[model samples]
Target: MLTFLLLRQLVQNAQSSSSSETVYLPLVTQPLIQSLPDAQQNHIQWMLDEAPYPALSAQAITVNLAEHEYLFLIGGGEQFNPQTGRLEQTSRVTRVELDENGQLGTWSDTGDLPHLPRRLHGFTATAVENMIFIIGGLNYPAGNSPIPRFNNKVYCAEVAENGTFDSWKARNQTWKINADTSYDYEESMAYHAAVFLNGRLYVMGGLRRGLYFSQSWDATRYVFSAEIDHSCEDLVWEQEETLPVPIRGHSAVAFERSDDKISEQAIYLFGGVTNDENDPTAVSYRANVGENGLEEWTPQAVIPGSAGIHAGTAVRSDEYLYYIAGTTQYDPKQNSARDNVYQTKILPDGDLQPWKALNALEYLYGHAAAVSTLGRLYVIGGAIVTNSTQMPLIQNTIYWTPLLFFSKESNPVGMVFPGEEIQYRFTIRSNNVRDLPGLVISDTLPTDLELVSAPNFFQNDRLLSSIRITLPINSKTWQTYTAVVTQPEIPVTINASTATATETVLPTNTSTLTAPATPTSTPPIRPTDDKTCVVSEVAPDSGTPRPKPTCTPTPVVTLSTTPTNTNTPTPTNTPTPTPTAMPTAVPEPVVVINVAELCFEGRCIWKSTAVTAPNRVYLPQIAK
Candidate 1:
């Protein structure tokens, strides 16, 4: 009965929603708590006994980049057997196909590793074209051997066109360092991070554990790089600059951006275990890949939510990087895993924006994650801690979710005046490995605005009533439409647009423009005192008004003659009248438009504010 209950609980947890609270904690020894109902106690006990453990320290990579790509899961500790009280690791290799509709097929075992005992874990795999490279890992000997050996060998295999891997072959040449000494430094490392870029293999920090109980484990900050020859036969390892701090159980990825003029590449390192084994560092770093080697490492935004996070997987899709589930916290008494997922946008200038959290999933750690060609994220085997005994149960399951990227923006986002033309730009980029087809973008302009011009691909209906277009994929398609604000009576107008792919889900975005009533000025009241003179004389040449002199009393003139008899004109003694200042016409107030970019979750839109206009309120349109 107990065994049956445990199995039932495992199945139920696996089928639960990704947002469900899957982490469990051990019970406390309190008398009041122990007095709780039996049903509640049984529920807690079920979570402890039934939750399936995750496959820890596995490596997953997508291969066979044809119409349908296959994701391969290789070498990890599968699960713990409660009866035997032992954790079981496997060397078996399995793969699943991703269909055209972005659906994953059932996982099937391909074959086991080509070595004695045929079991390994904590390895890193990189797929270059049709070839797959398996790096350093820990190998456990067959039978009841208590000690596991660290593997320094490199394995190569060719993935067949039909999504099957051929026979694996170990590289014969030893890693040559300085041509004077042939050393296998990688053999002493496991759980490190590795990435392949520009025909080079780069490996970062990992821990070296002693074979005996008396020897202490040491985490190293070493970094090494090897150039892959054209024939892919010979590789010479060269030591590069070490990391600022020694780390282990971290994840790394390579990003490359290219244009017509120049190409640049950089490597990013995520969270890992540093000097303290129990507490993981959330700090990340980025370094440029130059001709000589990696440049100086610069720190980036820290991962949020949890500080002691390690054994997580990081994958890049387009300009975004995702960090999947990991052990959230660990201690001698209790260890907890979490389903938290975080992502960050990679800017063009090689800087990372702040980390943003995504929807949660089942608690997992020491798992492997990959992004498929269909633009879907897949999380493979990982372990989960039980609430009763804190034992880990390896989970042999897979979960995936669809991913899409869409953004809409407008030029001159701020307050638009009457009779002014506004340009709206719609951009759709595909993060999928292949190009997507039949992407339709549609927008409806407010009644107060008029459409000026749009791209040839767009079909404008009745002077900005409705504009729609079908865009191409894998590129930023810009659609420009000049919208003229015709009516100033309407204080604010919103233009909402939606992008929908053939078989994809997307959100709607809106751009708002507030055209406050054109500033009006009242004509300055002219001064009309009783002494004022009215000008009504008409000019003979043009039909224009001529001003006549104001009526004033004449004064008697007096003159004084000089001795030389020179007739010097006497200075005018008439009292100078104070000039009356004409009333200054009031100028129209200047309208200052304040444009701001507002983002919620991953979607962003343009928001405009008229600084001169007061007490005006505008709200964003929420997508259902």
Candidate 2:
């Protein structure tokens, strides 16, 4: 069963009402936690197991576009029998799109990889610009032969909105695979880690076939750099740089930012086994990429525990790298895995602050994770060994946790029909506590797209134009820009690209009611108990019939009058009824009551904090 926690800020306000009337208040909520920088706060909340991938995860890869919180799970294998321990790979590509609210929707199949329909495991897929390039990978099929074959080919796919992939094309390679080079299997190794930095796809450490046990070391230590040529026909590879040790099952992450319009690029390497092939390493390495090529190789921190392989499935945000589940210490006897998640803070000098243990992952080994620009990390697909039964199993699971201060989504993206004006809701958020200086937001459109109008705020401030617009820092309002297809005959798609930037490199309710009895107020009974409510969005009524979830339509409030007691008190003469100036009068006390009800799934699950005048008891009728 898939399990996850729904964590939200719980808030509500109770108001006082007169005894003769009833009051209803809408729910109110407030932000519970203050914002912090992405590096400082841990997005380690209990992760959500999104709708699981449609396929099993023996060795699937997940690609996440940081700007768009979209996740793609591609190519994994399923074991037929537990006894044989055989793997079967498929060429299927599954797309998991996170809704605008950051919740995972249903999984959709986004076609298949180009060329052969083979399973891709242990290869690096890097997103450069609008396309993702899938490099050399192994295609292990369950034939009679025990040997597995790897592909020397590299494929590219165009990334479309809403998790759709297209334009699958293979890149031309210089290596001509013939009978002569077929023996040297290192030319096409799988299980390698990759990072794309400044147009360069850096491929590192993987394994290749050799003369069985009699052969010498078989791990490929050389890191190959692949970049796109001007024509985009094929990939250009630079001279490979050998690592200090030959490794495989490692992870490579390209982490950098823009400074003064110049790019600052760095790729970090973490966790892999040596040439011997089974022993994992906890050590990490780093290097800087410049115009010349890879430079300044630095051996980084060693994780505290035993050497771990597959640590590359880490989700990185800024300097913090969170290594989710992997093999803690590979066991030759029984394939042991770990669920521990470790955090390594990258320092300026290629050193790491001590690795801190965070939330434990449910599954480990061969999973993929990516942190969005908004600081949410998505973890998907892997193999896990359950504690109840220590048997290895394939997974099709997905989870996400907050890892940064900016949990809010910024990009204004949507789909529109042809010739329809799409009013893009442009939003700029200041993640810093201090005001950001000189902020600029830009939206670029194709020649076929038309800009309809400018926002009033932008026009009033003289920041709107056909080009880029400047936005004031800490502005919470969402500015709208209307764009339509200039030529309706053109194919309908996202015709415009929207972006928000800063000219200066800056970092980055309630209901109420009621009358009080003469001066004496109930001091609004503040219910110390707070509860959270989860509501689903309702679709608009269309001709297409979709069954409503058997919910009894809530009747709009319409009712008969509530009868009140108007009884007269029995007249009695009291001796002590001191008649001052031959006249005496009696005052009547005012009565008041209040109630709050908690509803769920079309019914009131709970009700509490109903207060009444000291001697009177009022039972509230819970909403059905």
TM-scores of the candidates are: 0.55, 0.56
TM-score of 1: 0.55
Model 2, span 403-496: residue lDDT tens: 2122111112222234555454433333211222332333344344566675542432323322232322233334456655444321222211
Per-candidate local distance difference test: 0.59, 0.51
Question: Residue 17, candidate 1: how far off, in angstroms?
Answer: 49
lDDT of 2 at 102: 47
Error of 2 at 511 (Å): 62
After aligning candidate 1 to the native by TM-score, how far in Å is the CA of 558 from where it should be?
99
* Candidate 2 local lDDT, residue 488: 30
Please give me the total number of clashing residue pairs in predicted model 2: 5
The numbered model that scores best in lDDT is: 1
Clashing pairs in 2: 43-402, 122-191, 172-234, 440-501, 440-502
lDDT of 1 by residue, 573-615 (tens): 3544443444332222112222222222222222222122212
Residue 393 CA displacement from its true place in model 1, Å = 2.4
